[model samples]
Target: MKKIYSIPVFLTMMFLVACSEDFLDLKPIAMETEETFYKDFDALDMTATAAYGILCTRDIFDYYIFMGYASAADDVEVGGENTNDWPQFQAVDRLQHSPMLSTIFDSWGYCYKGIRMTNEFLSRVDKIRATDTKVNQALVDQRIAEMKFLRAFYHFYLAVVYGGVPIADKIVDPSMFSTPRNSLKEVYDFMIKDLKEAIPYLKEKSQLAPNYGRVSKGAARALLAKILLYESSYAKNYPGDERFAGMQERWTEALQYAEEVINSGEYQLVGINGERFASWRNPNGGVGGYRWIFTLDGDNSPESIWEIQNVMDGKGWTYTRGSYIVTYFTVRYYYRPSDPTHSDRVVGGWSFNLPTSYMVNAFGNQDSRETGLHSVPVDPKLDPRFATSIGRPGDTILVNDQTEGEKWFPMSFSNLPTQTISRKYECSPQEYWNGRTNDNEGPMNVRWIRYADVVLMAAEAAYMAGDKPKALNYINQIRKRARMSGNTGYPEDLTDISFEDIVHERRL
Candidate 1:
């Protein structure tokens, strides 16, 4: 009887204890706890890496949201099977997007999501450094600098797209989730400060290993230059606009930073005068100075200041690490029954972000250009970038299969109303084969910032600062490269480049 009573007593105590809050308070053994995770250098670095993953995800840098951003420009039009397709993009294209828009919210939420990760990592780093002496201080410093750059990058884009966003430099408490937006000046000032502080600790492009897509000092300076240029342009364009008052003075600083990037000796143009980098990944080992910049071969080249790294593994639709955005831009095609393999031709795509006629005509008149074996009717007098940038109705597009070699066919798509496709970002056959899971995945790295873009920004800054000669010099550099890329004698350099010329060159 005593034994039975003791059993019941034990069972009751066990139940009560198990129900108590402290019962499950034990540290997680099989998993990681926040307290235990930041004790080492590698763990903190991994956290920084995870923060960078936000850039690779659909929430921040993927197709749907980016297409929405692109549609705002006249150069690109959102095309699909019909008007009902991808209404989010259509709303933005038509400038009818409201606060209820999902893409805007996604950008906002995911940007803050990235900021939260960086803030937490930074805060935890400080705490661990105070208490733990085993940490690698040097690596920690570099990682901290990287986080600052990334955080500022997010803020810069937000300010540009949706003026005066909230700046989150530290982890926010749940009670303070409704923080008010900062002024545009305040946001820009914060980004400038963070990037300047980070530049010293960040590595140069040359310091990083080949194909290392990490944030470098040149990227930081380039971004700083861009931010200042935008602010200066806004203020100059709208002098009475109080939001950008005094920003006109930033042109000198912008030019300084941009020139710094130009003179850094860490980057240069690839395929200058039709030269090819050994890194060029042409399936047939062909050469096109500017065209290869978008292919897998041109990734992480010296000309690329910053690129969003992507890989072609067998990742499915759920994965965002691959260049899924290319699929949207690629031309949609049907495999004919006679050529069921789609042998040597380009693969199919959903055909979004079709270039408008205004954009195509911007390149100038077309002429018959001579090929090695034949004469193809392309705009020889037009800007050489036309051949590399756009695949028109008469042009042949790339879809090289290694087994069958290179095959060229006329650009034909079933769903394209515009009857043209952007060739700059089409997925190569090599990338398609590598992404065995589906066409949705490709290995093309998104060239977010290139040396050419930096030079152009510098030109704008110089022009805004009342230095026309410097601006002309920069513009001429791009023209020279373009001439060489297409091996054309046309699109001659302007004797005196105007501000309009700078803008027009940028459109190309």
Candidate 2:
């Protein structure tokens, strides 16, 4: 009996002793840690790829938070059953929001999450470069540059939206969570520096062909120019703000970078009928130029500078890869098959972010026959892009395989007179009926930046630099493309251009 007891006691003592030395210090088993994860080039690439994933998250692009910010503009109305339906957006539209607002918090939190991801990736890659010789050095450099660009991209939004933001240049310890926001100038400077460093390593879009979604040298340049243009414009507006001191002079640098992207010859505006850059992939194809730019088929066109790639996983409410925001813009329960042949007619959505009458009216002279939001452009003197931009009661959309009946305004849903659906970002019937995606996961790539935007930025910068002809020529080019997109002879090239003209073109 004594000997048996002794044996059991001895075994128990051995187990405890074994655990005492390193039980808490054990490497993570359920997930990868820094030491265990960054073991190879593929792992490093994945880590870099994860940083890009945040751009597609609900906090960043998939939800109403960012679009809510746009609602503050006069063109859009936060449409639902009532003003309180989406109070977060309502607050933003009313300019009554605070940091405590959930959308505001989400935007700030997710941006930092993305920033931390990029910072950690950069650190891990740097360590790998220092210790590993077997890895491809060129790929390492490019990945590092890409991470830097991503970090800068995340920081750029924070600076623009919240003014000052904490610069997370590395993976920070939890204890340092209280890090204060840096000054606006400091934040912008960091972003500019990152882009400049990234430019040399990033391949041009031409070299990155067949993989057009990746960041390119032109993307970096365009972003840098945009940041500089923002800074220059802001400084001019509030010259007394010391944070923006000397930024007004940055317009020249902005123009230089903008022109660099333009001269790179890597991007072009998609012509009237998918003529230019025909090789670009569009899964569900269409014909209208400006309209096609927003569809699933327009995924990685030459015009897209930095597009966020989304997929239709059909994993509704399950963290799917699709851009759920499309659901919000779609017409609410607007699906009704008028004919047996039109079984796949237009589907409905949650009915948010409806266009205002003012926006539609801005496109052209409203006909007397048009009544409120039920606008009918009969012999409409509207801009050609207007047909593709705002989907009204009479406008017909692409059903599955054929063009079908006109879409009616959801009068029963809401009574707002000018409440009209935005065709620009809504999901198509094929996207819904394809058995993959639903209202929650529409597969549409958000074109974050485009070559057309770069051209406009160049025009703005040139105008600021006191070169009127250069600015006029740039604006005229955009107008020419607009006409081509619409297949209309109106909206002719301007004889002269002003700062207001550039602004109006941008609004379009």
Candidate 3:
């Protein structure tokens, strides 16, 4: 059993006893308990690594592994083997979810697990100085900062989901579990504090290895800008809220941080004709732009700000090696012929988060994300949003086979199966079935943050701060990247940008 820390002391004790042997013998050869860890910088580094590893678990990052956040939005429906397949997910779609939802407990428990691990590291990181030389102090300090950034991230994750989650900044007394929740403002403030402190200690992406995927200075700052933007949203909808009294100033900070990231020059948007996807999985890997971004080829693309790493092998789903959870939820649940080798595709997804027709129509005038090459035979006129906005009732949707590219077709029973499926992260049939349970679990590295999102965020922050020209500039930057080079889409240059326009841009 996996040990879930960061809950009440009694509960953690009970789990320790139940999950392992005696609590007194917390130091097992199989695992390092708090009593044995943090003795040196290396141990602390390992602990920090473990903290980051938690991001891949089904509890937190594996929303795709189970029912995901998309089902709660209006653009999708919780589809599965049947409407009753996952009532908790269905309840989310119906706005009828309760505390009893397993996802609720899982998400909450896993986030706190991450928090607890980071907190433990922070409390004991200083112990490294006792034995390690002073020359390596700065490196130790950077790791500590990374832990702080991760702690802030997990806290923010809980905040957005639970509104005002308890700020588990430290290993607390058992009594803290029942402690009153902090205000959303308080949570944001705490997260912001942690991030700000972490920023100075982190290195730029260029300093790290190309595929390093570790948290860098840009990641921490970019995330801080996002958090501030979210806080600005609260202020926008409720101006009377005192916590956001200086919302305009906050917006200014958001823009500043965003620009800082852009100026760093360490990362860039994956361009329309970039070599990032030169040969992602095969020779026909020239699907530039949006489709290219989602493939395994773009794992460490310049456009990717931060992402969870995924190796094609796995000791377990929660070990963070690679994930098939996205395929589990996004792919159509049933397989055609129910055979492993007939060449029919898209037969194993759990059919969750099915796109609504409204979503299909929302992608108007562009297909960067929507109906681009990866789309079905839906109408050509659509926004470049929601990658699967195309495909007519009976149109054929292509599936990539691991050995070959886009050769097989989905074996569907319905006349218009593509209408209900999302092709964004679905793996090829061969790759999906390469292992025992890996098909439900696959090797798609889930991208948590990317440059396009940051660009839009900067645009929104500028608009909210009463800078129309700046907002238009930012929006246009994203728009330019969304289309092929030299083909800047409509409103070639927006003389003015409005809040509603920003909203529409975000939707796209």
Which residue runs does candidate 1 get wrong by more than 4 Å?
A: 1-31, 64-66, 245-248, 277-285, 312-319, 334-346, 365-381, 398-406, 433-435
Point out where model 3 deviates above 4 Å: 1-37, 64-67, 240-249, 272-276, 279-285, 329-346, 365-406, 410-418, 434-436, 485-495
Candidate 2 vs 3: which has more TM-score: 2
- What's the lDDT for residue 392 in model 2? 67
lDDT of 3: 0.67
Can you rank all candidates by lDDT, best first?
1, 2, 3
TM-score of each: 0.86, 0.84, 0.80
lDDT of 2: 0.73
Q: For residues 173-232, what per-residue lDDT tens digits would candidate 2 score against the true structure? A: 989899998888888889999999999999998887777667889889999999999988
lDDT of each: 0.75, 0.73, 0.67
- Local accuracy of candidate 3 as per-residue lDDT tens digits, 1-508: 2344445776868877787445566546878666666556777777788798788775457554334567777667777667787777878778888877876667788888888889878878766677666438888778888888999999888877788878888987787879788778888889999999999999887787764668999899899999998887887777887644544347989988888888888776676443324533345745546666776666767888888887544556556466656554455523333366544344556655666666665554333333322122334232343443333333343454444554444445342332466556655545554444745356667787788888888888887788878888887676555554222242234456666566656655
Which model, 2 or 3, shows the larger lDDT? 2
Per-residue lDDT of model 1, residues 210-231, tens digit only: 6467899999999999988888
Q: Candidate 1 — worst ten consecutive residues by lDDT sum?
A: 366-375
For each predicted model, how many residue pairs clash, with residues at least 3 apart or on different chains? Answer: 2, 1, 25
Using lDDT as the measure, which candidate wins?
1
